[model samples]
Target chain A: MFEVENLTKKYDGFTLDGVSFKIERGYITGFIGANGAGKSTTLRSMLGVIKPDSGKVRAFGLDFEKNEQEIKNRIAFSSGAFDYYSHERADRVAKYYSNFFAKWDNEKYEHYKKVFSLDGKKKVRDFSAGMKVKFSLALALSHGAELFVFDEPTSGLDPIARDEMLTIFQDIVADGQKSVLYSTHITSDLDKCADYILFIHEGKIILDGTKEDIISEHTIVYGEKEQAATVKEKAIGIKENAYSFSALMKKSDAHSLSLTQEIPNLEDIMVYYSKGGKR
Target chain B: MSKNLKRRGTLCAILKKELFLATPLPFYLFALLGLMTAIPSYPIIVGIGYVALAIFNSDGFRRSNRDVEFTCTLPVERKDVVTSKTIFVVVIELLTLVFGVVGALLSVFLSSPNGNVVGLDPNLTFFGVAFSCFGVFNICYIPGYFKTGYKSGIPVLKGTIALLLVYSLVETAVNVVPRFNVIFDSLWGDFVFARAIVLVVGVIAYIILTVVANRIAQKRFEKVSL
Candidate 1:
């Protein structure tokens, strides 16, 4: 239930050019992008952490500016690099935030503390990186939020910790009422958890769709000189080999052109699309 | 919700955060220092009290990039956020006055006035100096909150330099011109009364400046990109 309309933000070195998107309720949406792709910028604007140069961000059918407090109360956000008040014990921080958030569930926080194996009495600075990430997620989850926005939530976690995180996310989405916007470079996690993928490049959303539609509906073409001519010039980039070429075109076109094979996986598609492949 | 209540809630949040970090250390240090000094130079002691309050309250403004980003994510309005910070400084100023008196009392007891220590009016003079220092602290302290994203290092350095320069200039002028004491004498019969007037006037000036800073801080925070 989030909509970003004609969101334009200009900076000295980068510009988010009127990017627009809608996140359906009851689905995990992955904001996928490489470094410096403006994914963090877009997420920040959505959370009202930073003001956009122009345009509107609507959450839960309300303008962010008008219903900021209400929207914030219903949503929880966490990032991998984000830190808790370091000198504060996790328990102390929880106590402090209990007043700020109306729906802060003390039972849920206790449950998470055990599940994450975090000592609530220990200062946050004493926790390991994985522990810190888990602590942040615990805080977000304990707030009884309807929507969770995670920015690279599993970046620094160990493999086991990352798996645990994914499991928690899966459990969160099982109710079919909650939603999440998970921004991460980890496509594998998205493949396991995200229902929708929005690929941001520079500042524009270059690709947006469900995982199946994004991967299965498209085809990557690789062939010799003759096959290169079969593809449209505008859609093709430089020919890598004398008798070999690769291009991205519709799968339907593949049947018409007698194509070779379909390159599956989100990563390949992202690489192909980012490197000037078009359809 | 009433706007005033909301503002107060926001202010409470900021004050709580600051108190958690710095309530006992620097705040109590002043009391300790005052006890050690034993109330000899009332004016200097009051000035120290003011600076201590200002510095302690000002710590909240120093934040790393991550802290700023996290804080901005809270639901509070930008104006309320800025106002809450200003309120925090004011609360510290008020607390400083209370502690300042306690310090003065300790100072008076420990000094055990000797014959050489003459012309030291312990009653009115001590309270007046302490109160005036609090007022001066308010005047100098509130403006820094308007700075970008609660940063204080620049403000702290600049404020210190400015205060020193002003003090030096005033001292030089009063010394170079023999009739300056005559002008001062006409202003107030004694130092205590003059300091009291300064305290009152400074507080009034501080309130006005706080309103201005609140407006500017609110406007600036609103435009700040996350």
Candidate 2:
């Protein structure tokens, strides 16, 4: 398990302000946010790939700054932007990567490579995007990492591959000892497997909880467009067409009680927020 | 410091990886560079190759697509990243110098003039000048590249300018200026004691410059978003 508290980063036009979250062991936490919502920034800063202006991170009962390499040894991190060493063969990259961690197991890497159908002699470019992700996971797993932090790992992958990745994530945490945290715009993937959801928007985490809890708390109320004015002010967010309107709000705060209230899925929640929250 | 001993990988791991990733050109070029030293009437441009090494590392052929990001994911510190690359540069400098001395020895015994036409003679003092140039290049290039973690072109350009001035001014003062002739031939061109003083001062300067460059590069790379 890991926790990041009050992580703050500032750039010229954007600021990730007081962002904080914690992930429990034995769960896949889906990080859903619109593009440029500070998901990658938070992940990089958490792993110390980039330094945050200020933050406190604790993982496996160790402080990040005080025990970076020790903590990194326990965590497997990959981002979509990571595709260096493409010209090198998988075995060679693994050999180089293996030297860094005392727990690195070549056998496990060999096993995963076989399972992923990755040729050892092939360069990274020879593999598909999905295979590349699996290759990174193979290296991370061989290193005995307890926490897997991936940024948009499923992006550009076909649905079948995405589903397979979800299954692999489940398998990783099956022993109730490991954890997986992934950020993606694909909410359907989370609906199928994520036990918990952390939604970030505009550099802030707007909502976070168990998937069931988050879904149960919010509902989408739909009605004729004529009735939109009545609910617009009360809805967390609203999407209105010329014919009908769908508004998201907490069930308790819902004013259009007579209207049909549909259970909002992860995508619905994300879309509603993206449409503009609290309007 | 107490926790450092507990870390699994040491700087050795990072250094090994660097060599594995870097091009083999510098090693092969070292010997040829020494041969360049034996060419009479040519300027001792051995430092030029080292300058080219900095530029080579910055481009697509030497590194491609988010190499910095991939490196950051490894079980290493940001400080280690800068330190390892700096060490790699220093290793290249060492190799070039070793071959240079070999070439200087060949020049002394084989009766070939070692590029004294327009610069400092291919002597111990020539090594001093090369060392000083590399020191300036390290400060300008290494830290400059780490500022954004991907831009090496400008740093190399600045380093080229700085080293050019050093190369030209030193070459002129020693060869064209009549005030400095004893260091070149007082005890045989490459063996003069005065040349040793220049050599020692240049080595010390290189050490100081390289260390300072490492510190600046580490600080800049830490802030880069990678």
Candidate 3:
């Protein structure tokens, strides 16, 4: 339901080069990258928070510039921080926020407020970090938003809170009509619920596919330090210790390399890919 | 057209949010100082300064509150964001001017009839001067703050300097020129009724400059990377 085309932004020393991705409907797309990997930059550019040097973002079949108000009405976005009107209560903020969108559902808002166990009268600044994320999600969901775009919503949350966030995301899409695109360095949450994965390294999109396809396409190769070369020759990226080594290579390449191969997780992929450093 | 109505709806909703949500209670408390115009022997222009300082200080609040970042998530355009903010500032300024008017009327009875020996008298001309000073502040601070969308200290500093300069120059000219007293003279004396003319021109200038400032702020803010 959302697409970014050739998004490029430049700064003094960094550039988001030809970044592109498409998020499918009814699935959670986890945009994973290290900090300063241009994840926020890309998302900001797409959302028009920052004008891109040059790019196009289409959402729900409408051009962002031409139909910003209409499109924004249909979409809900947050950085997962309840920093807007921070001095106000959630109930007060909701009253103000609901006016901006035609699809705002007060009953649904009440429902989520109860589901999240949010204190309506308390000031948002008093809430803990996890509570803030939950508050943001409740607001996003109450608006009957078809697409939810969040930036690092799970960061700084406890493991149980993160798991709750993942479940909320899963429940959001289980109906097979909604879509979510959340960017984060935290992959453990995604491991539980994300269906699609878009891995960004530096400014470019390095990997984009289904979670299963991406995990299955790569394997971890490891042995004694002396045999590092066997994996290094065919490996895309490798890390070595004094006594042993682990490298990442395509499943096909690892099979032919005749080295011990193991299945990889999202974190392993991020670790090995990031070793390449700034491109 | 329905498109125009839709656009107006968004603007009105955002304006409401700005006044009720975005703007803080401290802003209203500071505006109460606009009543300082009633203080006898005071420059009365200081009341306008109160409003200007409040406007400048609110920029710091906007930065800390992350108003730009929060507004970007709403169902509004970049232009809408800046437009609503400009309107909010001007509305508070107008309210302050309202208080200044009441105080000026009271000053007519409470202060010296020949006008204060201090600076400018809190007369009809004072409102004109007030409007002009506020206009100068709008020109400086609007574009200045919107240019960065984050930094406000330096912008407010520059705006304050400009505001003070305008206040001093105008007050000094009226007090020292001797011939420009026609501005404070009889309603129909000469120069096509000087007091009325000054009031009309000052109000118009304030309106025009505010419109220009809003336009400039909107354009600059559109380029900001929030």
Chain A TM per candidate, in order of listing = 0.92, 0.97, 0.96
lDDT string for model 2 (A7-106, tens) is: 9999888898888999999999999999999999999989888789999999999999888888888999999623768877888888888888879888
Q: What TM-score do all the candidates reach, one by one?
A: 0.84, 0.93, 0.95
Model 1 ranges off by over 4 Å: A225-243, A277-279, B1-11, B21-65, B105-147, B165-195
The number of clashing residue pairs in model 1 is 2
Better of 1 and 3 by DockQ: 3
Cα lDDT of model 2 by residue, B130-207, tens digit: 889889988998899898877778887888788878877886776665658645533263447778888899999999
Weakest ten-residue segment in model 2 chain A by summed lDDT: A80-89
Model 2 ranges off by over 4 Å: A277-279, B1-8, B22-31, B46-50, B53-55, B58-65, B108-115, B185-191
Best by TM-score: 3
Best candidate, lDDT: 3
Q: Write the per-residue lDDT of candidate 1 for residues A4-113, one digit (tens) a residue.
A: 98788889999987888998878889888888888888888877776788888898889998878778878888866447577668787767666557678999999999
**lDDT score for residue A38 of model 3:** 88
lDDT tens digits by residue: candidate 3, B172-221: 78667787754663223455456667778788989998899989999999
* DockQ values, each candidate: 0.43, 0.67, 0.79
Worst 10 residues of 1 chain B by lDDT: B115-124
Q: For every candidate, give the share of true A-B contacts it also has.
A: 0.38, 0.71, 0.82
What would the per-residue lDDT of candidate 3 be over residues A33-114, giving only the tens digit for each residue? 9999988888878888888999888989999889888888888888766777678898998898888887888999999999
